[model samples]
Target: MNAQFFGGPYDGLSLATAEVNRYGRVVSKRFKGQRVHFVLLPPLADWERVRAGEVDSAPKHPYELVKTGDNVAFHDADVNERFNEILRAPEEA
Candidate 1:
């Protein structure tokens, strides 16, 4: 699936699964009824670095993209707790 992102660092980007993983992971799948949330995070560089502890993959900005089907919405969220919660959440199987 491809989602269009607006606001934050990834603004104006329309990315696929592979491209999206470069910035952050899909923390939520159908989180709020057909909506997928992608947390905006710090530069990860690569998975090797992520496993090497060389990159901090934490939320860099209070921004995330919520995609519902083909439509995507960007939010500048202030709730850190929610970000952390979703960050640790497993994608729905």
Candidate 2:
């Protein structure tokens, strides 16, 4: 007998599916219990643009942006301690 387990680029990556609604909002519950959110950050090269107000900051939306719960992939890590730094709570700052 043989068996194969599902795999992805990274442990943080997963599969999910969602349905798009009006206003271009995709509603889904792939992260129902986890409450994961999606964040849209500007490109690193946009530093000057951002400082000049040309580039906008990440949108307020990220969580539950999708629901398909399929074909979605992500990766998480603590590279250079940067990830932990970002994970720090607001009050901790």
Candidate 3:
């Protein structure tokens, strides 16, 4: 589930993956930021509930649940900005 940022300045913040559970459910997603990298684990039973639509509350972030594609992407305008910033920054030489 490794993903590369295909566009924007902070393209280096790429190669992310979702952690899976024993049942092959995605339990978390990880991404690297300019100053920090983060792992966002699904809330307790969040995957089951999201799939079932049993919970009334909507997910705060957009996520993709697809099965028929070579690549799937999830992005928002803010994410695009962040990525661009990360890519354009000067690197240590």
lDDT string, candidate 1, 11-59, tens digits: 6756565545665644555443455565555542443465466765664
| Per-residue alpha-carbon lDDT of candidate 3 for residues 35-93, written as tens digits (9 for 90 to 100) | 42222223434646644666543333222222337764333323545434433556533
Highest TM-score, which number? 1
Q: lDDT of each structure?
A: 0.56, 0.30, 0.36
Error of 2 at 51 (Å): 2.7
lDDT of 2 by residue, 1-93 (tens): 111112221223232222112111322222223434332223335434655777564422222222344433322222243224344523321
Listed per model in order, the count of residue pairs whose N, CA or C atoms clash below 3 Å is 0, 15, 6
- For residue 3, give model 2's deviation from the true position in Å: 41
Q: Which ten residues in a row have the lowest lDDT in candidate 3?
A: 19-28
Assess candidate 2 and give its lDDT: 0.30
lDDT-wise, the better of 2 and 3 is 3
Residue 68 in model 1: lDDT = 72
- What is candidate 1's CA lDDT for residue 87? 47
Q: With candidate 2 superimposed using the best TM-score fit, by how many Å does residue 19's alpha carbon deviate from the native?
A: 30
| Backbone collision tally, model 1 | 0
